[model samples]
Target: MSEIVTTRQQTPGDLQRLDEAPTPAEYLGRMLSDRPALRIGTRTSPMAMAQAGTVQRLLDERAGVASEIVGISTSGDQWMGDLSKLGGKGAFLKQIERALVMGHVDIAVHAMKDVPGDVPLAEGTALAAYLPREDVHDVLVVREGSKYRSLDEMPPGTRIGTSAVRRKAQLLKHRPDLHVDRLRGNVNSRIAKLDAEAQFEAIVLNASGLRRTGLEHRATEVLSTDIMCPPVGSGVVGVQCRTADTAIAEALRLLDDPMTRTLITAERTMLHGLQGHCNSPIAGHATMTGDGQLSLKGMVFTREGGKFAYAQEWDAPDRAAELGAYVAAVLLRKGARGIIDGIPH
Candidate 1:
């Protein structure tokens, strides 16, 4: 076996070398007669397990790789309070990432939206690929038999539970009378609370999560992007691996969907340029046109939802990151800086 290498900073030369390396199958055939089984690391939540299963299946089909699922608990899972207070979306990722960096697992699967805009990857680790995306819209899950069909139709002062600052701000912007309360837990727990306690009229959840968990029927209405733009990288699953492990990285690349990667790059680039975290009321989405141009739309809102700014841009697909940065600049010029700067760390 090769000695494991761990290095934090990657140079341009290192990336060039990896690009020149052989594909996983090619390398494996030449170096080892026996195929190595991989261990995939993920959070223990049912939704996380389902996502990991997707990646496992993809690897098996695409690269003829064998793998085992390894569930890992994270700080984000243990914390019961606001995610914002725990350093945003990355909280859910730290422990899983540690296992990957320490070689306890060969791969880390993540809900792309939970990946921080500024990813703090362990030494030598990189996001190798993205799976085909799921629905990129937010949905309103009202208690079964509720008369409310959508956010606009809900009665004034209707309480909606959600931990996402982006959802809370947008819901308030659309209907100032709606009460936004903090709601945290896995998909099942939140739904159970909504059904049994009746503390909230509805709750906002990612449509992809519901679909992944086989609970899509729970969503009363899929909120359109017009009403609620999704957070950056919302509907995708990212596969992370050590960059030094070219075999694993190449195998994961077999699952990468080019269009999904392009869209998420633009969205994440926009978030990175704006210096926004999960706590910030930031939302962005990118789409590829039939003509090959990429369109990016982004929004930033005041913490209180009293004010907001939005911007959009279109460019060649190859210029996705540039388009994201351009949109961020446009929003900043429209006084979005005040709103973003005011968010608590």
Candidate 2:
């Protein structure tokens, strides 16, 4: 089993200053030239590569910097069995993060949803920036020959596939008569199963992921958050670097989206407060209202979807963490802890 770790380091003062350069672009270009092309560590998945490309593009646009993608075969991607057996979602990031610690990569690009909220970041690493968010909705993708076009259209005992415990609980809660089974593999393989005469009438997936894979056309319907509350940290790509890498941090800061940061912060804070495991069916979503207030909703469910707790709250955007904590406390008061503890990992 790979462990999630990175080197703890301290930044040494550079004698150079921004004012020393003729312009901001020139300054950044000079700074970038001080080292080899920036190395971005990522998984080998199409989605992961797409995210890494996005970072590279942003760097070129914002700081006149070039980058190289360092694809890593993470233990999570290599493991074909259940992720829970490997101690949950952390399996996906441990090796890639370790690469950063070993100086093989300067930055790590992660689909924020794949990151585990229950644990702090690997030692010596920090989440420096969040790319602007994409649509966070989960969508239904029906098999080509299936009779069902929507969850409501499906008759009793209709089969749906998804490996996420979050989706399973939510689906059962919404339509208990429909059979929800675990579907494994990446988006391409999962869809191949559906098109390869598998038993699933439909499979649920994230809209942004579909878009990233250029498979959005395969989606049958976009589900509302009310029906399928997104998991925490959905629809965002996070940039992570060594904690002491001041130059890297400064460069990544240029790509940060403050609004996305606030939304993800609130959602992730609530998730961490729940102390959820991989099998814990927890869902959360946060949004900025028209008037600039932050609204957060959180949920917890039992494995069978027979028991659950939910809470929503509002606060100022700057109080994102406070709002998340408040919603988490409310849900706990509503028995979210018992529901969370009752599930098997």
Candidate 3:
């Protein structure tokens, strides 16, 4: 992968300033002078294509630039087994990032939740901007003719299909008698399986994915955050690009939602601090209050759902990382470390 290119000329004073210092508008203005047509790399899934289309529309409206979509097949797209065994969520991003690094594409559009907390990126490539977030909650999709309105309403030993360890743990924690089975595939595939296969009574899925794919009508119940804490970065779509490609970066910046960025940064920071991967039974959700303060809630559970830790913290929006770390520290002190360590990579 190509390394990130830094276009800024660093001076002694610039080196002394904090890294968080804002870039001068003059610099951004100069970069915006040329709106280069961009090629965005994305997975071939319908939902992924829809997300890329969203980015394409935003670029047309905000940056007045034309763009083409490039469909890239990722390891996660082909893998039929467990995601963790294939290297967690990073599997979904590797080929897309490769396309950016190789100059085949100018930007990579992805679901933020599919991004691993600490995966290394090409030196010059970074997440440039986050689109406005969608509903950050999980939903239950029951088979047709099922009378269940919620997980609690299901009968004991009801087979629930979901691939996420966090969802598995949370479901078992609340209903020990429910049967949790691994359900793999894209959003449409999972729903099809739930409807056509008699083995599964219901399945759990992210609300954002369903909404993005126009399948929200299939959701039988939208689980509250209190009932099921969302994964870090859920509901947010992000654009990644070479840092040195200031034109693309500035163009994508037009789509950045400040509050969403702050909240996702905090949640991802907490996940990073805990060294949690996609398969780890870890959950976090961050939200901004009307007054601009941020609150973060995090949870960690054992593989068997026998032990768990939970913590929450609040801080200024600018201190999102600090707040995430604080809550992570609290959870670790409460034995979250043991829970995380016991999970297989």
Candidate 4:
């Protein structure tokens, strides 16, 4: 089906539900084949719009469903300071999720990493689908025409920019001399600072995020997992809808990649088990093994990177969550609990 992409801006608030809205089952049964355009809610950030557009395209191309991208300004977007002040990562999602519940949008799109693993899905909502995984790696963003092309190549006292404490901890653990300073803003503004000012030698960004924003060429070098472990749910786009919308949920599930789903299940299970706050320097990754088993690796680090714990475990693909919990158990046994408690998010 040929699809037309449409963008709409919606206000986020306690929208009054239509007094006589159709029943949940009727909403699905009413238009299985000839449905109204699905409204996809997302933040208004450039990366967010790009991610939502991708979803709009996929639903049209793969499922023959039409969609409209709805951009909602969220609290996280409005607040430039510490995210912890607005309730950590949840700040980014509150308004959009509320729109979904209010019937202002039929679905919500999110970068899975931004979703807090410790928090339950907002009441009455469910994660219905996930796009195929992208590169689950961190990359270096150095100034154009700079001599530094990679992490190790940079000299001592080199100042690096990043927002996530996980990245800071891992970077410090790798090179104690290099400085990992907090850098915030959308990817574009962050890169702008690298070029306009001499304050930062380089900045680290997600490889997948750069690709989604069509800025992959800016990546100076891809950091191997050995050097920089990724956060849980990186490189994945998750779709959320009302819990009672079973038909819509199943339709979206058709677009999901099973392998990616299992991997995320493992990674998120570990994250939930750890109960690590947004400030906690916890990292975990899951990948399919060559032998058809699932391998999960998890790490916990002090904010300063001096103390850490790591564990890796394997299980059948069907046991993704089991492998995740087992790995968390191993890390906790090795004193991850103490390190996690010491950090104040």
Choose the strongest candidate by TM-score. 2
Best by lDDT: 2
Total colliding residue pairs, candidate 2: 0
Write down the RMSD of all candidates, one decimal each: 10.2, 10.6, 10.1, 12.0
lDDT against the true structure, per candidate, is 0.87, 0.90, 0.87, 0.88
Model 4 C-alpha lDDT per residue in residues 43-68, reported as the tens digit of each score = 98788899999888877666666789
Inter-residue clash pairs, candidate 1: none
TM-score of each: 0.89, 0.92, 0.89, 0.89
Q: What C-alpha root-mean-square deviation, in Å, does candidate 1 show against the real structure? A: 10.2
lDDT of 4: 0.88
> What RMSD value applies to candidate 4?
12.0
Model 4 collision count: 0
Scored by lDDT, model 3 comes in at: 0.87
User: Who is ahead in TM-score, 1 or 3?
Assistant: 1
What TM-score does structure 2 among the candidates reach? 0.92
User: Tens-digit lDDT track for model 3 on 1-345?
Assistant: 999987988888887786646454335444554655679899999899999999999877766667889999999999979988788889999889888998999999999888888777778998888999998989999988788878878999899999888898898888889899899999999888888877899999999899888999999898888878898888899999999887678768878888888998899889888987666898999988788789999999986566899998899999998999999899999988888887777
User: Considering lDDT, where higher is better, how would the candidates rank from best to worst?
Assistant: 2, 4, 1, 3
